[model samples]
Target: MASPASQDIKSIGIWIRVSTEDQVRGESPEHHEQRARAYAELKGWHVAEVYRLDAVSGKSVMAHPIAKRMLTDIRTGAITGLVFSKLARLARNTKELLEFAEVFRACNADMISLAESIDTSTPAGRLFFTMIAAMAQWEREEIADRVKASIPIRAKLGKPIGGAAPYGYRWRDKKLEVDTEAAPVRVLAYELFAEHQRKKTVARILNERGYRTRNGASFSDGAVGRMIEDPTAKGLYRANYTTVGESGAGWQLKPEDEWIWTPVEPIVSEELWERCNGLLAARATGRRPAKKTSYLFAGFAVCECGAKMYVPARRGKYVCAACLNKIPVDDLETLYRSELADFLLSPEEMSAHHAAANEMLREKELLIDAAESELKKIVGSENELFDLYHAGALNKVDFGRRHKPLSERRAQIEDELPRLEAERDVLKIGMLSRDEVLEDAKDLSDKWPDLPWEHRRQIVETITDRIVIGKEGVEIILLQVPFGNDDELATKPLGPRFRGDERY
Candidate 1:
């Protein structure tokens, strides 16, 4: 019974979301769907699909798979409009609501909320939607302020404020207690630091003795330093002394006057804690350690047990503190360089790299061409609309209504064209970067002695990802040249010289 013009007008999707409160109130999802479907029918629009978020919280649906599918549908032009019972039903999260609006706007799609009477098909409706998003953002900020205000007060009461208990401690029934298994290791760390007066040395000794952190990770110098500094090990727990900085600036210490300290069971005596900390203070004021010369693969080497290999002061070999695994610096460099040469020089690898690059370029070009063709058709349609309006075929009101969608679509395609072109340019540059990496490897193979230290180091860093030294042999892992699958350096382990027993 629909006219051809009405059938071709709009392809809309229904969005139904019923929260627990609404469900308890006897508001069924089917009620919302039927309302949206009737509205779509009245507007002479096709009901393309129905996206249901039944019983899902509106606070955060952006991470939900159904929500993602709805966004994808909008982007792919599978649905040109979405009809929902209300804005809050779509998402109560201000950020998520704003994100949905932005995505719809970007895709040149409409969002119609029946309750609010917002139809983004018109200019006034778009303005109202913006105002609603701004109000929601304000509400979110108010909630965040309330949460921040409670943190200090909660800390003063000795309640479990938030976050996991410190190392060697666990929370049981909202109370902090020493973890018996980790407590002994924590105690040994302080004793070792008091004796050696070196955090790295203490960490190394603990690791070699088969001791691991509560998280089952080999102890690092930084981890040992933190454990030593924590007052929790000495019968006192400190909180409200630091605040997290905005945007990943990391934690910053609050003023000492505001710090809250509470007493708890001790893992080590305060005397032992003070003695170890005093030695650390003395070392801080003393002459710094001499800077060791950099090796060809200083930070790029790892032990098979997942510990980084480091050269100790006055040592000529990379040592794994965890398992006492050792590999000569020169041997690792020679082995890596040889593997790099084979990877870069092989004809098969070169062919595969070129083929992958070409395939990506071809796909990008096809997309660019399709976008250009779509833009052309939109522009042609705009010309026809103007021609019809001037020739008295369409009146002013009808002309304006029909032209708005075409204009919005043209803007979207115009924005998308440049982005596709930029991606094509990046793919071309990526191919060139891969060629340069190959050239660097070739130069390193032929002119190792003649190249500057910095040049050789740069090449090694670019091509080699890591060198793993184990009891059996060495495994050389190379970084993928050219945005392709990691040409994982041959997994077969190398000779006995790379074994743990080899030492300087």
Candidate 2:
């Protein structure tokens, strides 16, 4: 039966929904609202309000709080009719759509689908709506079948099916590739965690160094722990892990064999990745005890026994939990300083730096000479311009215009001249500071008994990369201080690489 004209809704609520993607299927929230508004306006229905579910998808319609709130509004008769651009925006599943339809009917509310021109208030319209719903559901099922068949293939081929790329990587060619800037931070984080076996400690160090995660957030203990344990770091991708929930919406993990494996460029070595995961696993079960002292090389030293070197509550002893390796703290410190104390004091070590410094010195001298020549040319040009103006060979305006820029250029060069001359022999500063550190360190020997423990420790730590006390005696990996050819070592930035038992 046809409804009375008086039963026609005079006012309606405008509902717009957007997917998590900014735009899905080329449909934007604004475009959907504009189209719905035009249709409602054609029937002379006033838009009482607009409700948007923006950037929110993936949740079931029942679980969407906003959707529930809308239901409450409809029941209370806030608007004559609830209108959306399409039925799919209301609910993806036909079952949920029917539930929503029943709610509208019970509320004595009219629902209008702008795209289908279906008004549930009319018998004929309701019948058409049901038929459309059935067909749409069938179409959705067919689409799902196609997606299910293809998505796994994409995953197995090492392609990112969708969503954001993992940390230390960016999406390129539909695959995850190492992000140059973030990859180092990720690798360094793994190294730090492997050595200290503490996520909180590693997080603190990374945060202090101004490193942030992929989301531009500071690392937390839990976040760092999850990152290290993630297999994606080692380029072994896992896919098909999540499947559609059996009951309805959302996803659940599939059986292990269903997981997809993909290969990508690894940021950290396999051993480094394994060590961190092992430590994370161990810490999950039982964390190791905290050290009682913060010695000079506290967390910076490693033992060949595969455990971090720890100084007991007593200051002069180092012990490794993994093996019977033990060392007198004094003997270890003495050996480290003797072999790799100050690179500046060693003629062989400083030779490269000295050569680089001399080259820089010569370059600066040539720059100064070039600057003087340029300055003299500018002055001569200015003088010639003035003589030409006096002889009327040039106009005053032209002379002023040309002279002003040259004068500014001359002033700029003049300003830069002193800074150029004052450029310190870069090599000398690098060498002297190093020599001073060693000389200061030498004073910390037993002969200088007045030195405070804290001071002595700081001096030693400032120059050392890490002190590895192993069966191969004491190996001290000093900072690779190169005055000249500095970029050579700097180019290949590494956190720490472990080759078999080698510790750095």
Clashing pairs in 1: none
User: What TM-score does model 2 achieve against the real structure?
Assistant: 0.27
Model 1 C-alpha lDDT per residue in residues 475-499, reported as the tens digit of each score:
7754433354322112223222344
The top-ranked prediction according to TM-score is: 1
Please list the residue runs of candidate 2 whose C-alpha ends up more than 4 Å from where it truly belongs after superposition: 1-160, 243-252, 287-504
How does candidate 2 score on lDDT? Answer: 0.61
Give, for candidate 2, the lowest lDDT window spanning 10 residues: 487-496
Predicted candidate 2 versus true structure: per-residue lDDT over 1-504, tens digit per residue: 112122222456878887866475655576567656655543335676677888766245655667755655554344547778667787777656765775565444568775554555433345554665466446546644655578788889987576567778888876678899888888888989878878899999999999888778999998888688777787555555777997877987675435555556778765567556545544554533211225656655668665676665664667776785667766655555445434434566556544554666566668778987998899899999999999999998999998999999988886665445333222222234344555554434444346566555545434444566666565565533434443222111112322222321
- The TM-scores, one per candidate, come to 0.28, 0.27
